[model samples]
Target: MSAKQTGTKNRSPMQYSDWPIEQLPGLSQEEQSQLQNCGIKTTVGLVKQGKTLQDKVALAKKLQVNLQYVNKWVALADLARIPSVGTQYCGLLLHSGVASVAQLAQTPTHRLHKQILRLQVATMQRRDLCPAIEQVQQWSQQARIVLSDEC
Candidate 1:
């Protein structure tokens, strides 16, 4: 069975140009500079360079940072490939347990919405700031479309 059949979907390794790494949320200017210095100026570059655990480990070693840092950045970069998700919502989705476009595509919107709402309320103390159910559904739908396009 394929990864998808086993309930673990994987994104295509195709490298496509996307928003610059600086646009990704939670990355500081210094972090952006460090990545740019290593030829990972764009999200797509980061994703391509850190496609696997070994790749992420190599990147972290090269940057002299922890593996988790590269993992988070790569996850953000991968999620940002979704047109609707973009950089603005990548961090949110990651924190909400939707790390990649594949995960988001398989996630049930109702459950994912609840997770996002709880996270927002716990972190920001603002339930109103959570994306609506329809928006969450749209994200999942778009993620599926993206996965299909990749295949």
Candidate 2:
């Protein structure tokens, strides 16, 4: 049944971020299982459980991964909270220097677009594959919405 039919509002990640952890890029199957073992099977869980530096350090100790790995994973999970910039493009946004949804929200769209374009050209060797300006604008707008919802 649809959310409307169920009397629900179909909230976005801005309100309740909860996508499968596997959907976030770069996590190995083992890592997914490890997180799942800790009852963190979704992005929301990762974000909530790893919110602080101390939490991240504890997670690193439990998962037996580098502190940097846990930090990067938490960042990816945080970015995935933006509905328009979900798992698919969260990594791109990160590599393009967007460390958080708040950053994406405040960044000038054209500048962010240029950064993404430069990274795409340098790594993918194809500017054509870069996201369009319109899409980038949507991400920024959605990020702003997400941030506003937090307040």
Candidate 3:
């Protein structure tokens, strides 16, 4: 596909400050304050930063919290910031070898669906798959970023 055609069909790149805070559930007052202190006042900030463990650790240290706490917050923040990627689906994606939003975006639809279904069955979980697939499509269209397979 041509660049112009692709750009016209996808979601525009969103700014961190533009998103609302209410979408991110379970954020403690202290965590919120810490995020704000680090210029991460919105869900988008957390999503963009949380793509890497280094970034999460840095943010956690800044907040004086453990890495696991930051990771959970990052997952919640990513779900809140990105449309169609809910917490449950995010977990499934992780279980299916998708470690980042970029990886989810890069995944082909059929393979992603199969993996998601497999994960659902193995984990004994139920969730609507359409939204997650849609999210992957939307994210792929919007971002050219790809995830490295290596840890």
Candidate 4:
């Protein structure tokens, strides 16, 4: 089904831009710099093959850091790469207890839409914040593809 068929409108969703890797959530300043030194500059730059986290394991080994930490950053960056999720929306998802793309993949689209709606209301920036169910479907589908161990 299409968004138009489902009565989903654009609602002026927030626009996202590429941010420095240091801006990725859940990472300390040291870790951000570490990734930067290792050549990861932007969230989009971290992953190459679609939604996969690219070479997180290899990067961890090269950086001599905990694999979990690298994996965490990779996941966050992956979510940021979603068409509309961006860094700001990723922050909202993290604060709302949705941490990983894998978790986002599991979340019901209606629930995500509801939570995001509540967030927009609570924040009082309701301008064009409403999202259609179809957008959430795209997000979940993309996450699922990324999490299908296809990386």
Candidate 5:
């Protein structure tokens, strides 16, 4: 399936109550209950915070989840949003010294190629990274244009 189709198809129910919070890592029962109460049950819910640190922190607090956990959810969400990028590849990118979406977007093709090679060595499987790198570059260019327009 195309990435857009996969995204729509993979979407969880809109209601937070429908999420299986028990399956989330490192969440206590109390935290789960609090998250449900605050209308944030799915990982995606936690990741949709507006573009502000305070917003993310408040959301995390309301859900009784750690701020770091919320940050991680956001990072994972961003990686998932990237076409052809998965959690494993995201981890590999981090291990290869690319820690954030901005960093990944700004990375040169040569560096990205080297990182992917390193990841292949660790995983014993080759990953096609060109699509993801191209996507990042496109996103970065668009973001720059938007930011410049705002300024």
Candidate 6:
């Protein structure tokens, strides 16, 4: 076990914020387990190489899975690293083609907000999927923080 995994019995869940893969956004519980079963047990495992399209394709080939799934998982890992954008919002962003917090941080909030509104309208069955402007702003701000911290 890693030093981070050590003493898990005594650690409160909130006591650690370093488990990026465990906290990956946009994944159902089952999908998370599946990724681990397929040997992607860490955020670095999925995204260690700058998370390029080529990297995702390589992972898909290595795991013998669909490219789309690998892409989404990489995106989820990246987004989950941000403090404010949790799993639920991660889904919303995924639908908007946001594959990383780096992308989110660079996006203009108004553009993302409008894009989400359009997505909601296109997928009209889920009328309750509204994301507030303030929340998106916070996500973008937090994404910036995460990017800086990684550097």
For model 3, the superposed segments whose C-alpha errors exceed 4 Å read 1-18, 25-30, 37-39, 48-54, 75-81, 84-92, 124-139, 142-151
lDDT of 1 at 102: 91
How do the residues 5-118 of candidate 5 rate in per-residue lDDT, one tens digit apiece? 122222222111112333344456876677668776554454455246998789777766678876655554444333334333444555566655566657775666666676
Score each candidate by Cα lDDT. Answer: 0.82, 0.82, 0.56, 0.65, 0.51, 0.67
lDDT of 2 at 33: 93
On TM-score, the stronger of 3 and 5 is 3
Total clashes for model 2: 0
Model 1 bad stretches (over 4 Å): 1-17
> Model 6: per-residue lDDT, tens digit, 28-133?
6877777677666766565664367887787677667788888777777566555466544666788887877789999999999988888998888554676788
Position 76, candidate 6: lDDT: 70
Q: Summing lDDT over every window of 10 consecutive residues in candidate 1, give the lowest-scoring window.
A: 1-10
RMSD of each: 7.9, 4.2, 7.6, 9.2, 7.4, 6.4
lDDT of 3 by residue, 17-90 (tens): 22444334567777677778788766666777776888888877888988987887676555333344443344
lDDT of 1: 0.82
TM-score of each: 0.86, 0.88, 0.55, 0.54, 0.50, 0.70
**Lowest lDDT block of 10, candidate 4:** 1-10
Clashing pairs in 2: none
lDDT of model number 6: 0.67
Best prediction by TM-score: 2
TM-score of 5: 0.50
Least well predicted 10-residue stretch by lDDT in candidate 3: 1-10
Per-residue lDDT tens digits for candidate 2, residues 22-106, read 7778999999999999999888788889988999999999999999999888889888877667777889999999988789999
